[model samples]
Target: VQMLWIPFWAAGIVNGVGHYWGYRNFEAQDASTNLSPWGVIIGGEELHNNHHTYPTSAKFSVKPYEFDIGWAYISLMQKVGWATVKKMPPKLQLGAVKPVADEKTLEALIANRYEVMAAYARGVRQACKEEIAALQARHADVSVLTAAKRWLHRDTEKVPAVVLPQLAQVRAAHPSLDKMVAMREELRQLWLNTTQSREQLTADLQAWCRRAEESGVAALREFSLRLRSAQA
Candidate 1:
């Protein structure tokens, strides 16, 4: 009974502490986090973010510095012919390609949309922070900058109604912000436009990459270049 209860208690910590602490490798919408890179006491369950990123992966440790005791145990069991790993998530590989997105690009984007969105958010926040600071410095009454920060990653529908006007003001002041917002929405819509045929989707994705590269924002351009070569 003690053995059973002890395992249950430790597993419970995977949820309670897992979602609230540590750093995230993938920016999943949920609050999931890794409690520790070294999954020592929790049977490698402490790497919750990696687990969420690749749910079917038998090994949770993603970074070079991380350790997965559970995966080590699994390897030992497999060597003894007692265990088998059915599926492991494929890693995304990028290579030089034409300037347009192709089927492989779409596959990679679909598999790693969360990662792209997280990167997009970070880029936007960094850009916006600089813009807001410049605005505040020029105009003492730039209190609306606070609202811009709050509405950083929110889509138009999710942004608070009261803050919409301020957000618009910020966008008007920063052309980069407008481009980032448009690029984000375009990517989201591209993914959701499932009714389009494969050929059409490929064309649309290629067009999206073209626009992203021409957008003049460094992050968007870099992401577009990366997208051109993405493969699952």
Candidate 2:
């Protein structure tokens, strides 16, 4: 029974369904997901996406909405001096807006890239709402947006191959939304390029922020302000 439960259930089910289905807390590079926010089964392994995001974290649950039973047990052990925790996930904080994107801003942006991108996802959703309404007012074809909307918040590589044409169409139709999506990729490049010096990245970030704030898109401008306030 132990052999079956540990090897078969734990090894097979968690690894299988964990990669295949469920909501993601963080957009981990791989397809990992939380089995449930109330992670009651298989210790804390149900919070599989959280596990992938912070592989070394002893506590699996990160969000306020999530509850990991294994983390509860770990806390109990900690109270009894039976356990010790080491590394946990990094936090993304927002402080007073900086005058410019400096070295510290670059460091914070890179350190919390995933969280930063998730916040950018919110800005993308806003772009969607604004663009969709504008298109409706003009009586234009909204199918392009309907296609692009599903994948806009996701990474470029994660966008479905078939939907690529629709995304292109979206760009052609809506100039404001086009600028937002293109800027999203430009923002991602600030961290993706490794050869650039810290100073160079800071300059690049400053340039990016200047462009965003001046882009004429209200959502993009607000997002730049939020980006300026990010802290490590």
Candidate 3:
């Protein structure tokens, strides 16, 4: 059993529970999921979704919060002349905020789309909490706000079907939340359509920033400014 233990755990637990549960950094094709952000348990196989997305990359962790023990081991080995690492995860570098989002902004945002989306998701959650508090003070029905905060953290498609009507109610009831959800989907378009030329894409991104800034939502304005800081 000792000889078979490691392989059995790798084949069964890693590939089994790895896909069946946990969060994803990228929108991979398959159902692969990262079993945990701290990859000590499965020796970095916990970052299964990242593995599926970047099969050739030596690193598994992509998000800043995630840790890959396997990559740490590889790094130690390389330092000692025992291993070589070629491909690695991409990173988003932010620079001074530009007057507008340009081609460089578009390139960086696309290159680090997962990280960008995660940041946006965090922004939405923060905004929702503020909005919810304000609404509660006004004696509004704040029950929906709690659920809205949870569902809004996810992409529109990822939201459960059963909660669509509730989400619709939340949108209809709250102006700030409604605008945030609508603008979140619009932000997604910057990377989704690949048919557009660089000039066209840059133009689209510039226009997106303008709309976001003028949307009257403070969160949207801040997010747009952050987008302007993306450096390729």
Candidate 4:
């Protein structure tokens, strides 16, 4: 269990170093800062103020006193033949010359950005659900009419216009609509197949009962005795 803590500490150091001393590209309202200090051990707990500004960053150490315990453990593990240390991707590592931003400004900016994105996602999902429900209702209406028309004409269109339009709309609104529809259809077919199998099994059981009814009681008794002997 102590070994499990190794990764946590390592991650914390990276986060601390990035936040405390690393440069902030954007002007976050919060003082969440970054450390620019080179080397592993110097990185420590990313200051809370800096994290509030740039929470997504990986490195935490920015100053000399900010010693990262996690990075130290990882280095120890690598030396002891138990672990490997990989450098952060070039995209994640900071440039030496970039300036750190104030903590309060950074925090407000990040918070506002999150709120806007979340609101937009929620709004889109709500609108999609409503549109899909309306389309389904329209499809049900056309299905009823189609059944009635088929009774009179005996020939119906292969695909209904309502279904086609609804499908197109759903596809446009939700990129995963096709996958969802396919999953639903697969589940429906599985249910139908299960029902058919259950019906066949019931019929088979009834037929077996009928055959048993025709068999002599003496034959059943002998079969029971044989079963008991086998178990023994």
Q: Per-residue lDDT of 98-172 in model 4, one digit per residue for the tens?
A: 122223222222234322222323333343455456658776333432332212111113335645565554445
lDDT of 1 by residue, 21-61 (tens): 78777655566788888987767888888888778889988
The candidates, ranked best first by TM-score, are 2, 3, 1, 4
Candidates in order, TM-scores: namely: 0.73, 0.89, 0.86, 0.21
lDDT per residue (tens digit) for residues 1-232 in model 3: 4334547766889789877789777656576888889887666777999998888899998878999888898999999999999998777788899988888898898888877777887778888888788988989878887876778756667667998898999889878878888887777876787788989989988988898899898888998898899899
Model 2: per-residue Cα lDDT over 59-101, one tens digit each: 8898899888878888999999999978777888889999987
| Between candidates 2 and 4, the TM-score winner | 2
Pitting candidate 1 against candidate 3, the one with the higher TM-score is 3
Give all candidate RMSDs, comma-separated.
Answer: 4.1, 2.3, 2.7, 26.9
- Scored by TM-score, the top model is 2
- Candidate 1 regions exceeding 4 Å error are 1-7, 79-82, 118-122, 125-173
Q: Assess each prediction's global lDDT (C-alpha) against the native.
A: 0.77, 0.83, 0.82, 0.37
Clashing pairs in 3: none
Clashing pairs in 1: none
Stretches of candidate 4 off by over 4 Å are 2-111, 140-232
Give the clash count for each candidate: 0, 0, 0, 39
Q: In candidate 2, which residue ranges exceed 4 Å CA deviation?
A: 1-7, 136-141
